[model samples]
Every structure is written in structure tokens, then in C-alpha cells.
Target chain A: MIAEGRIVIDLSRNGDVRLTSNRGADVARLLVGRDPREALDLLPRLFSLCGHAHVAAARVAVQEDVTEAEAHADTSRVLAETAREHLLRILTGWRVEGAGFELPSPPVMGLVKNMQAAVGDPAEERQVSALLAGYLETHVFGISPAAFLKLRDLAEFTNWLDGGPTLAKAYLCQIVAHGWQGLGAVSTQFLPALSGAQLQALMAEPSFTLRPEWHGQPHETGPLARQSRHPVVAALLELHGAGLMSRLVARLVDLAKIPTQMTTGESPVRGQPGVGVVETARGRLVHAARQEHGQLKDYQILAPTEWNFHPEGVAVQALAGLHAVTGRAEGAQALIEAIDPCVAFEVRAA
Target chain B: MCLAIPAEVVAITDDKQTATVSLEGVRKDISLALLTDVEPGDFVLIHVGYALNKISPDEAARTLALMAELEEVSS
Candidate 1:
């Protein structure tokens, strides 16, 4: 809700990336004494970007009586939110790329209801799916998602992107134009799922969320990490080595399969201060809470931004060696946007 | 973790840590873990899942008096 701080990529002389961040989640500190149910209801309002995901995670973490139907709905909500998030990025990027498109709002709202329906039942799925596919084809990739997904290599991706002035293609073209292709390279090291005990234990230390670590090493936890196993993402990794292009491609890979993914994946079930690890738009979102008499004794959340933006973390590894990069601050911003922080940030070349 | 706002404690569980707080017209259950000797009428800053601080009546009245004086001076 506020401009937390700035990530200054110093290309002027040092060419170093410095994120002078002033973000603090005092909200969680306040929740220390609140009832678990109150905490659960408030989670959605707290995180505007992924309210459903947050509430779902909180509900699970508190061991609330979540029905099977509710779990499925929550899973679909994550998928829908992710899809909209990707589309919004593409939409905004296209505008920046000088594309004369006029899709003021994404049609994702229509699909939201269906997204909450029972997975695989196909509740209004056909209509919503077609609309989304058409919009992506018409406004984003300039090719069918199926066609984009079928792309086997970088060459194929380039050819498909070369077809028209859609959002992603235009941005990809800009990346190619600026020759910022291989910049912001980071290898994916995903944070494995933690049990309730493990998560609570890890979170016991202060500054754990501020500087999150996975097995004592900083790791990446976003679309790139989630879709690392996909073939196109693998191809991008092979070609670009998890650089800006690979990370961006991984996002598109996520975008491509959203229709199918939204209607299929099931959330994991756990009871007693349960830990729900949902792959939100940003990355791995962990919600952990312990309850006493159905009241929250303790609660904690580890958002993807913490993992990606740690002081000695993925951003440092990904954003190095760009001092001599020509696009300067704008280029730095593109790279940072590729990583996508959950909170507000200001990026400048120092 | 979240944006905290002041809410009035409407109800409390027997444990004294858990309570319901009303914000505007909406009432939600929240934790009172950060403050002690809280009652149904007390105001607290609600966040992620807990109350960060309790707003005392003395502080509120002092702030109100300061604002009133500032308004009179401006007038």
C-alpha cells in the first residue's frame, strides 16, 4: 500500500545494485494477540494482490474447518489470480512498448467465478477459457497460447514473437533491441516445502522474514523457480541461463498453461496449525499458524518477495554485471520487474 | 505483513487473548496478545492476525484537545 523503498542499481560508476529498502510488516506483529478467525478474515484485506491466497493459507495455517469444496475454490483462486497477474504485467508492458492496444481491463473478472467452482467440473469454463485465450492471442503473445507453449527452443520463441506487436513480444523485442538478453542471470534454487514444525522453528528467529534462507542459503522463489521443470523454460534456461529472458519466459510459460492449470491443481490438506505452501503470483507463499482452542497462538507469513529480495539473495546474483549495461536505470527496472517485488519499490541507476 | 488499523474490541473469549474487533461497520475476530487488561470497549491496532497496541482514552482525549486548539487558532 506504500512505496516501501528503492532498489538503486548503480550504473553511474560502481554498477552495483543497492536496494535501500524501508519495508516493515508491523501488521503481523499486531496480530500476535488476535483470534485466529479474526486473523483469517483480515488476511485477505491485508494483501490486496493475493487476498484469496492469503486467506486460504491463513485458514489452513489456523487449522480452521475448511471443507473440501472450500479448498478447491482456494486453489482455483490462486490460479485465477496468477493468470490475471501475468496478464496485467503483459498489458502494462505492452503499453510501455508503444503498442497501440486498448484493453483497459482484463477479462479475468469473468473467469473468477468459474475459477472458484469445483475443479474439473468445467463450470462456465469454455466461455471464460475462450475469452482469455483470445485476449492473450490478440493482445499479448500474438499467437495462441497452445502455439506459444509448443515452442521448443529459443529460435522458435523468437520467430513466434517476431510475428506482431503484442505485449510480451514487444517487450521481448525491446530486451533484444537493448541487448539486455543475458543480464540479470540467476540459477533457480527453490525453497522446499516445510512442515508446520519446521516452518515455525525457522521463523522463531527475528529477521528471518527480512532475510529468508532455505537450508541456510538464499534462493529464488518465483515463476522462474516454479516453472523450471517446463520444457520451454528449460529451453530458455539452456539458452539464457536463468537470466532476464529465462525468468520472463518462465512467466509466459506460466501464462500459457493457466487455463488448464486453473481447473486442475488441488491444494494440499493439513491440520493443526497447518502450513499451506501456495505458489502465488510472486512465488512461494507460506502461511503458518498455531492455535489454542481454535484461537491463534502464533501466526507468520513468508511471502516470495522476502526470498527474491534478500540482501545476499537472488536479486544480488541475478542483477550483477549490469554496470556497463546501456539502458541504465530503465534496463535495471526491467530486470527488477522481471523478478517482481511484492511491495512497492523505486529503482534507479546511482 | 499487513496494514494495521484501529478497531474497537467488541467481544472477548475466556482466554483473554482472542477477541472480536469492530472496524467501521464490519466486525472481525482478532488477537489481543500484545496488550493486557483489555476490555470490550478498548481500541487496538489490528494487523496480520494480532493487536499491536491499545489506544488509551487519555491519549485519544489529548489528541482531540490538541486538534481542537489547533482548529480554534486557525479560525
Candidate 2:
């Protein structure tokens, strides 16, 4: 005898689960049979940016039936999310710098030059390199420094300082010297500041508070790597703050890291119900599912951008509220950027 | 589909298949699959791996400014 069924999963902040099933065979015949090992593989293509999150959730849903290691699943989800955020930030940074309007200085120019030299296409490299160099002399230095300063203010307010005054000083020196190698070293040095406990907590839930003294002001979100390594989070109360630069940097960084983190092996567990959640470039993203008899019974995703980018309505207010009060365009822009709304990622008009 | 954002074309590729664009401080590599006759410094709304349409940054700023003005008037 053969049987078939389909299940749909929906996710929201409310955390509700609903299931319905229909069987083609008689109850008596079905009771005599064993569970089937049907292959389900349409999950990964959902969102290119959050593919890891979906995979992690699917693994947890499948493993719930057999293993007592639910916590491990959660931990793995967090780590993957952190890694994803890091890569996104890097990619975003590369693209933004590549925009040909915001070079830091000569030192930064040299770095761009080196990248073009290594790119292997002479025509493309020459065009991009010259464009970037020209942009630095005109627009990049004109707007970005002020933008960076405003970002620094937002960072301070959110208690997520970008490496405090010391690292900022070193970063400035590298910028002055065009020492790309030194800049890379300085960036690597800051990674050790993230504690294991903080990473664990971030994976488990949303909103971790720091001490009042350390809170400073409202920081930003989005860039996970910049936020994680931002000096303010460490110096103030040992808590990571959220703000625009942090959020933007986190997503940009994650874009650069994704290609390196792709693993070629099957997940450890593949046939039980589980949950996966990660702090994406936006905020907290979660995926949960239920599996029965080796098939997907239910699946759902809660996107981080949904929480931050709520449209202007009663139940869902836009982040533009605070910006409205500040009356500073840069401040408002900074705040909005921090949300890192992936409207494209959330649209399911189809 | 993919996680991509809308950005203004600060520069265009010679073939126009790709463009350098910016959104806030974050920029991206956008494909010209969804729009026609795009040029430098024009805003384009982007989605997962595709450009959906051309947006006017000036118009966007004007709208936001109007919103701010309305709030001030009400206050």
C-alpha cells in the first residue's frame, strides 16, 4: 500500500502550531505499516541569505523525535547566525566601497588598488580602480566622514562603540598610512572580545540588557561583526549594543563570510522536529518545523527584518518615529539604516 | 529569493549588465534585469538577485521631508 500527505508551517511572534492530515489508505491498513523514509529537499532555496537558518531549523525539527540534544541544535543555530551576519557585513562593505563615491583616503585607495590588481581582469580592474580613486578625491571623503561621525554618535548612544577611542586611533593611523595590512591585523585583534556566554544568550533569545552605566545611549543593529567587536559594547558594561553602523556592518560582513562557511556534508540529524534561530543582519530570525515518519509535517520562518521594518500602521509602526523627533536627517538616516530592512527577503506576494 | 536592497546607481558598467549602487552606507552589485536605460546616480529598487525598478532619490527625499513637515505642523 502507498500513502501521501502534505503539511504547511507558519511562523510569527505568537508561536502557534496548527496541523492537519489526510490519509489515502484505510486506518486498519495504515496501522499495520511502518514509517516511510521520504526525501524532502525544497527547503534550502527559500532565502539565499538565510539558507543556513532554514537548514538548522529543519535539522532540529527532525531530531526532536530521537535526541535529547535540543540545546545543541539551538547553539549550532546561534553560531551559524553569527557567522552569517559576519559575512553579510563584509560583502556589504565591499559593495558600498565599490560604489565609487566613498573612499576613506590614500591609504584606503591603495587597498582598493591592490584589490583591482588581484582581480585578474585588466579592463574591469583599470576602470574600477580609476573610478574609485577619483571618487575618493571628491565624494567619499566629502560625505562619509560626516556620515561616519554621525554613525559614531549613534554607536555611542547605543553603547556599542566602534572599538572605543584606542582602536579608533589605530584605525585612523592605518587610514593615514594606507596600511591595509595593519588595518586587517587590527580588525582581527578585536574578534576575541566576544565572550562565549554572550554568543550563547544571543542565540537563545532577543534583547539582552546591559548595566545602566554601560548602556550609554541607543546604539544601532544590522552589522553583527562591527557590533560584536565595537569597543563600546566591551568598555561600557560588557554588553553588545545595536545601532545603524553595527547593523549595516553586520550584514555587510556576513555577505563576505558566507562563501567560506558552506559545508558539503549532510546535517547530523535529518528526520525529527527541531527549531533554529539566529540574530541576522537585521535582528532575530527563527525557523521551526515538525516532521513525522520521515517527512515534513510543518515548517515556518520568523524573519528579523519583519520585526524591525514594520510598516507605518497601528499595530506595526515604522522606525521613523524616533527620527521624526531628532529633526536631524543624518540621525534619521542612521537609525533607518540600522534596521537593515530586507523587504525583498520578506515579500511573498506570489 | 535573495537578500538584496534598493540602492542608487552611483556608477554603471560599460555593458550595463552590472552597476555599482549604494543604500545608506551599504552598497551592492545590482543586475539590470528589471529596468531599462539605467544611468549613473539613479535610484533602483532591488530584490533577490534582480533589479525591480528605478526609484527617484530626490522624490524619496521630498516625500520624507514632507512627512516631517506634516508632523511639525501637527505638533
Over B1-46, each residue of candidate 2 has an lDDT whose tens digit, in order, gives: 1321236788778888788777655677876743567898776655
For model 2, the superposed segments whose C-alpha errors exceed 4 Å read A1-40, A63-231, A234-273, A310-333, A345-350, B1-13, B16-75
Give the per-residue lDDT of model 2 (tens digit) for A1-350. 11211112122223222222221122111111222222113333223344445445444444445443443333333334444333233223223211232223333213322432434444543444344334322432222222333333334533322233322222222323332211111111111222334433332343322110012222222344334543432332232223333333344333333212222111222222345444454544444444466545544444444333323211012222222232233333333333444432221110
Q: Please name the candidate that would achieve the greatest DockQ relative to the true structure.
A: 2
Docking class of 1: incorrect
Q: What is the lDDT of residue A82 in candidate 2?
A: 45
lDDT of 1 by residue, B20-55 (tens): 987655788886644567898887755445664566
lDDT string for model 1 (A1-350, tens) is: 22223344344466566655555434454345678777766565444456676777777777457777677667767777778767655554433455555553526433455555534566665456666778777776778888888887767777887886765777777887777677876665877656667777777667786788867898888788878877778877877787888888889888888766644554433434466667777887777666677566666677778888887777766666576667666766777778887655566555
TM-score of chain A of each: 0.88, 0.38
lDDT of 1 at A136: 76
TM-score of chain B of 1: 0.67
Task: Quote each prediction's TM-score.
Answer: 0.75, 0.37
lDDT: which candidate is best?
1
fnat, candidate 2? 0.13
